[model samples]
Target chain A: MDKYLNSQIAKIDTSGIRKVFDLASKIKDPVNLSIGEPDFGFIPDVAKSLHEAIDSKCYKYTNTWGLSELRVAVAAKLKMTKKSDVLPEEVLITAGASGALDLLFRVITEPRDEIIIFDPYFMFYHELPRMLGANVIVLPTTKEFWPDIEALKKNINKKTKAVIINSPNNPTGAVYPERIIKDIIDVLDPYDTLLVSDEVYEDFIYDVGHVSPLCFYENTILVSSFSKNLALTGQRVGYAAGSRGVLMAMAKLQQYTYVCAPHLAQVAALQNLNLDISNYVSEYKERRDLIYDMLKDTFEIQKPEGAFYIYPKVGDGEKVALKSIEKDLIVVPGQVFSKSNEYLRISYAAPKDVLIKGANILKEVADELR
Target chain B: MDKYLNSQIAKIDTSGIRKVFDLASKIKDPVNLSIGEPDFGFIPDVAKSLHEAIDSKCYKYTNTWGLSELRVAVAAKLKMTKKSDVLPEEVLITAGASGALDLLFRVITEPRDEIIIFDPYFMFYHELPRMLGANVIVLPTTKEFWPDIEALKKNINKKTKAVIINSPNNPTGAVYPERIIKDIIDVLDPYDTLLVSDEVYEDFIYDVGHVSPLCFYENTILVSSFSKNLALTGQRVGYAAGSRGVLMAMAKLQQYTYVCAPHLAQVAALQNLNLDISNYVSEYKERRDLIYDMLKDTFEIQKPEGAFYIYPKVGDGEKVALKSIEKDLIVVPGQVFSKSNEYLRISYAAPKDVLIKGANILKEVADELR
Candidate 1:
């Protein structure tokens, strides 16, 4: 039989995160923190909304852009947080942050177009750009896990189509502060480069205010989902909002891709957005604090200002990860995110007891490695 | 802003079916015979299964292929169909048939590959192939909607990668007879062509036994969804089953596209598949009978062997479509399905009352045109 796969399939590796996740599933009693999903259940009202939607026959296909009411709600939410003056026309609901990211890269990049990403970044971001036939330029971040603005400025050139920013950062969970966000935006401001900001963890920020590049730049496409904030990861509802011009382009791409986000999920997200989700925010913050305290006392770990992860420096991060696996505690090695192999990302999104058990196992593994 | 959109975005025109649909949505008390969706509500037990899934925490991401249980169920279902001996590894649950179709096009066709389609086919099939940078070789079926095997054989060249067959076809409601299907397969048997069978309406066939190309061809990729069969369109649960090779290639492509199908939907589909769905199938068969009787009495329409649509010759399909719109009835013109503008396709998936109302409006329009 002819090789049925496309060339792009061979070029991109299966996600390292997914590989570890699959491994964790087979091991009995494994405490998994490998995948980048919030461990909380879907908020009660969100689940109720979904059940109501299914009963209402909201399971049919929605408009290709998405459900209008959901788009309007997303626009309203964006307006409040980032001062983004986008209307519903400028929002495109997608499968998830992953879907939005893939669409953005595919629509914006032609073959050989250059997209810049900060290293020690979301691994999928790097993989997506390459899969779309674009060169991914990685500008390494500073020691504190913020984008190196100087490196970003130097990397900007005419071929640069977009620069992807994730805050709070995946794997590391380092939220970029406002001044640094503005600095990065200013550097790209001179060029006609689009800024792709993934703020899926926006509601999970701890000490710092979530800074949106959309606030400083009109050319930004802000991608987010209810997965993290409302604990609806399996629902797979997300949106990308930006200038009407950019969104219209993305919408056309989406029409050719998956048509629209799943309708039932869209209704659930619409309700999730409208309802008060302060309880989830507070609960996650408590979990983050507890995990941070444990890591700080035992290991050299940077306290994340946001997101559900803490990157702790353990000697030979991969070896530590393997040791944790032996102890039935699963964590991601730093090399999955970047070249750094001294640190591992430990998720605090699990229940308090699961986190406690995993943390104790991690401490034992670290001591054995030392 | 340097036109942040890729050149390919400009190449796609929004589906022509959508334009008529938009106009239909505005018509007060309109009889919508335009949408291709099954108009029945989800089976009560299926809805209950979904509700239970949501109440449980099936809201986390499933395996990228789908939930293992769902895959196993799908594989068993495929086995029952006797299309091909497929395993769980040879099945992938997708968001909908739309997602599966898009992924199939993406993985199978590289730039400049050729895909064959029967003219007067499902409109989306034409659009999707074009979107993938593949040139479509359209062979017009006979006036009675049977495959033109000679023309199909003539179109096969070194570049021809796949042929799309929508049995119990959309727009025309034509089901290829067993003899015709075997003839089409004979034409493709010698060539290195992949038969892409879209059997979304497999369960709705009135008189004919549905025979998927997979039954004869080992290289077939079968795409289907529970949307029509279980009336769960909005739930967005579908699957592609075929040879292990084709499924693996699609899985790699899906990993880059949307990752996986929604978790809760997969759970619902899994549970629903276990239940006897004879009642849903029987209800659709009744609706199909009512439409066939009405169309034969009211206008010059061929009795569709299967599916929910009937293509009736109306003087200048576009003009009849406009007249139907004026009378608050919505139907897709044949021009949307192909370049031919001589017929209109009306869906009979609605309740008998609604279908009768639409048929009356269409009859009036046809009489006026005559």
Candidate 2:
């Protein structure tokens, strides 16, 4: 019966992260940092709002586009944050940032269409377009993980349907500065290729405020989720803001796909629209400093300005990760996020003590491997 | 930008039911019978369980397969209810039954694969497979909405990848008896066509017990949801039970698609697994009787055995539905669910007074059209 499985699905293996997760589960009290979601939970106010929503019987299906009030609120929030005039119709509440990308890809991709992504990307950026029958063109980033504007310029062609930009990118934690974002957008503008900006880490930037391509590119679909910022990863609620043409197409695809974002999560988001995350940002910033300072001398690495991960240049990352795991620490290897296997992605989203212990173990492993 | 839309998504329009939903929302005091979900909300115990889950901080991602204990509970429940020796590994919790079908079709369908469905079927049974690039073969049912076993035999061929069975069906609400289910399974046994049974309405039968194809067929993927039975429609928690090979394939697809079912809903489902739904069932049963009894005199109709709907054989269903809506009543035309436009599908899952008013308005529209 396995022969009946779709060729596309059967061709892909389980994600590299899942393999590490499985290994972590088997080890006892491993200082796990392979997980992508926030280590904390939602604030009490968010839970209270959800409780009220349940009491008020908000468990029925909302509009396929999502609750009208929630959409309005999301539009307002996006407008203030992205500094773009986002209308309610331009915002679509999705199951999560992952769900948003799935819908966006389904709407835009045709067989053999080319989608360009920077190397050291979120893994799905590569897998999803391929599964949808699109060819993924991997453009290498600089050693510091900034988008290579020249590489992006050279990659565009008639078949290039879209280019993905993940600010505060996973694995590398390279938050694209405004100047880099503008340069990338300028390169793709003549081709009118769609820009998909994944900004789920928008709230966690430490050095500078976040920059979104939505403000500069009309063809951009900006995808973000509350999963990280609100610690609601399991709630599966996110939104996509884009031009009405593409967003409407996404909403229609969403009806048959996700139906709508989870009702409880949407309601929680509505109430916490004004949530202050400076405390979380500060906490993670301190951890980022702690881990980077602890490992800087031992391993050659770039200082991360956003998100909670630090990638250290270690030879045979999977080997180092495996060796580190033997000492009760879990971290993801860079090959999972890129074609290269020379670095380790250690998440600083864990507690300070866990980060401290995990960093020392990773450092020891790197030294032993050298 | 619409020119860039995927050809598959661009080819389809908004569903017929959605048009009526939009129309219904505009009118004041509309007696809406167009909803596909249970009108009531979740039971109190379910809410209490969710509250506890939130308080206990179940706000992180569960395993992509779903929460392990919930999967175990669901497998155990299926063993007793489905009367099959179901194993925990054979179950994959999904965002909803819709998500299950989406993943299932993605796993099984290749371009131009043929999927068979009985006419007067759920709208998605036609749309989802087509979106996956499969050709949908709609076989007509009897007047009472029973699968014509002879038609089943005729439709099977090398290209036929699967057959969908929705007992206690949507729109028509015909619950297949055990004998018919066994006969359908026998007809497709030779070709080994996969059976995708949507049993979301299993808990709503008024007269007879539910008979799942899973009890008799090993190649069946039984899809059911807590939406209708537990009144968690917006919660989007459901599961698929099938042979481990297919379920595993679906699980693999789920990692990139839905990621996982909403965590809070899974927690709620786990806590309320043994919820008593007899009261809600009996309430809907009475409303079903009331609508059928009232409308039988004016129009030729089949009494729905389950699933909160009745299809009256009205001429030009859309015209009747439109005329009825002017009187501030809402119902769906048959064209949404089937190729034919000769019937009206009225949901009886409303307050008794609303059902009474909607039924009378429907009768008047049918008479005026006649």
Return the clash pairs for model 2, or none: none
Cα lDDT of model 1 by residue, A1-370, tens digit: 3376667656666555555666666788778776678766777888898889888988677777899988888888888988888888988999888888877777687889999998787877877778778899988888788999999888899999999999998878899988998898889889968899999998877777888988679889899887777777877778898867767877776776677788888888887786776676687789888888877877887778888888888878878887788778899988788767888888877888988898898889877767
- Individual DockQ of the candidates? 0.61, 0.75
Each prediction's fraction of true contacts recovered:
0.66, 0.76
lDDT of 2 by residue, B1-370 (tens): 4866888886555668777777778998788888888877768889898888899899888888899998899888988998877788889999999999888988899989999999898877888788888999999998789999899888789899999999898889899988889999898888888989999999999998899988789898999888888889998999998878888988887887679999989998988887889999999999989999999988888889999999988889889988988999989999998899998888888999999898888877777877
lDDT at B161 for candidate 1? 87
lDDT of 2: 0.88
Tell me the spans in candidate 2 whose CA falls farther than 4 Å from its real position. none
lDDT over C-alpha atoms for residue B74 of model 1: 88
lDDT of 1 by residue, B144-171 (tens): 7877888988888778888899988887
Worst 10 residues of 1 chain A by lDDT: A14-23
